[model samples]
Target: MMIIKEPKELQQELKRRRFEAAKQGRELTVGLVPTMGYLHEGHASLIRKARANDVVVLSIFVNPIQFGPNEDLDRYPRDAARDLALAEKECVDIVFMPEVQHMYPQPTKTKIQVEGLTSSLCGASRPGHFDGVTTVVAKLFHITKPDFAYFGMKDAQQVAVLSQMVADLNMDVQLVPCPIVRESDGMALSSRNVYLNEEQRSQALVLSASLKEAYELVQEQKSTTAAELKKLLTERIEAKPLAEIDYVEVLTFPELEPISEQTRLSDYEGDIIAALAVKFGSTRLIDNMLFQKKDVALHV
Candidate 1:
């Protein structure tokens, strides 16, 4: 596996590989898995999906642009040696570990922002967050030029926003959303999980529990009202002494538009995602579940 630190060098090498494959009458399918430096099972799952392609490039850059001023940018996480070992285990073709200077040699004058989709959820809480996300992703897509970009469903909002950006910009890349990797006890795998102490870690289960409760309520009780679902989720998280609710939102999937309190579950005809962000001590975590009423008519 090649460990490339320079953006230009990696771009040139990928271009050469594509040209060579074309000359040999071989169709090359390249896949890219973009991630921050802390590699975990969730990231590994993305790599596994990318393995189906002819070449897989995993980027391990902790993008500063995507982080807010007060966010964990400085102390996010990093272990190049460990990440490389994990990528090697997955048989990744390339590991792009570009420096911040290499990724943005000068002050970035331009930014990519997806409107409407960024108006709520993580976007509402973290201003300019999606702009940073879309900008860096756009740069990565241009540099790697992969046939498909793999992203985990854990960051559902990020996936949705990027999908819109790709479609609007007519970028020649397909975004593949993988399922969320979780622990046996139902905690969603996150790089920040390392920061959680034993107590805080246990408390983090509330996020998953709330999601499960929401799923069950929709499935068993036929609970479909957004307000009632949010109230139930809030109550579940609030019951846990250590868990603090950041936001519990029930919105339409992909569109991400808020559902009115008057909207009934039976009236809604498509997938609805119940997403929540909670804080345990200083560490914040997010989890979500997507479900729809069985009796609701499918909308094509």
Candidate 2:
């Protein structure tokens, strides 16, 4: 496995590989698994999915642009030795680890924004966050030239936003969203989970618990309105003293259109996501469960 830091060199190397593969009368399908390091089972799941492609290119850059001023940019987490070892273990052909200077080089003059979709959920709380995500992912798409890019559904909003960006811009790469990898106890895996203290770590299970409750509620047809479900999720999370609510919302999937507080779940013909973001002490975590509406019944 090759660990490439320079952008031009990586791009040229990919070009050469493509030419060589074509000359040998072989079709090469590159799969990209983009990540901000501190590898975990969640990231490993994405890498495993990418293994289906002819070539897997894992890009490990802690993107500076996506972070807000108050965010954990400096102390996000980094262990290059471990990340490289995991990349090799995953059988990734190329690992792109670019520095901020290599990715930015100079001040970024342009930004990519998907309107309407960015108006709610995590986007509402973290302003300009998706813009940075789209910009960087676009650059990776250009550099890797992957036929498919794997992303975990743990970041459902990110999956939706990036999918829109790909379609709107007519990008050739196909996005493959894998399932959310959870701990046996049910907390969604995140690099930031490392920051959680003992008590905070236990309290973090409320996130997955709330989502599971929401899922059961929807499946049983006990909760009908968006407001009813959101209230249940809020109350469940608030029960844990350490849990602080960020946003609890039930919105249409992909479009991310908000469901009216009094609107019946059956009134929505398509799928909807029950998503919440909460802070456990200084660490903030997000979780969601998607439900598909069928007649008066909703299935998870």
Candidate 3:
């Protein structure tokens, strides 16, 4: 595996081989797994998914533009050395760990919006967060031009938005969605897990617990109604002292147009994604679960 610090260095390195490969009439199948630096088991899960296919290229750049002024950018957990060591262990082909300046030059103006999908949930809280995410991911897609891209379902909205942009704009890469990785305690693993205090940490369980409650309720065929499910999860999380519910929305997968009411199995079509974002003290964490209606679809 190679560590590329500069964008030009990465582009320069890719150019030589891309040309050579293009000349031979061979289409290179590459997979890109994008992440912020603080590598955890959840991140490893993404790497494992990418490595299972063709050449896996991971980009580790903790985007500042994505962070709100009040959000934790400076305090955000990052260890490139730690991340690189972990990536090497996973046999990642190339680790594109670029600096901030290398990613975005002075006073960036333009942003990418996938429309409709990003305005709710995490977007409701972190305004322009998805724009930054989409912009960067789109840039990455253009830079690497991978055959497919991998992202954890933990950031369901971002995935949906990016997927939409790709579909709408007809981008050439396939979006490979992966399942959410969790800790034994049911907390969905995130890089921000490091910020949790002893007390705040315990309160964070309410987020997943509420989701679990929804899952269990729906599984029992008791209350699959969206309002009932949303309310059920919302009240439980609000009961926690440290937790503040940013948005407990249940939506249709791929499109993310908040489905406030889901009853019959037919109503919740294709893959269903349940996503939630909560704040513990000043830090925010997001997690989601992907429910497939085909094989593992819940029924009594």
Tell me, by lDDT, which candidate is best: 2
lDDT of each: 0.88, 0.89, 0.79
Clashing pairs in 1: none
153-176, model 2: which lDDT tens digit per residue?
889999999999999999999999
Ranking the candidates on lDDT from highest down gives: 2, 1, 3
Our model 2 lands, by Cα RMSD against the true structure, at 2.2
lDDT score, candidate 2, position 232: 89
For model 1, how does the per-residue alpha-carbon lDDT over 1-300 read when each residue is reduced to its tens digit?
999988889899999999999999998899999999789999999999999999999999898988889998988878989999999999999999999999999989999989999989899888999999999999999899999999988899999999999999999999998888888899899999998999999888988887887776766665467788888889988988988777889889889988897676657878788899998988889988876555432111
- Structure candidate 3, residue pairs in collision: none
50 Cα displacement, candidate 1 (Å): 0.6
Clash counts for the predictions, in order: 0, 0, 0
> What TM-score would candidate 1 get against the native?
0.95
TM-score of each: 0.95, 0.95, 0.91
If both were scored by lDDT, which would come out higher, candidate 1 or candidate 2? Answer: 2
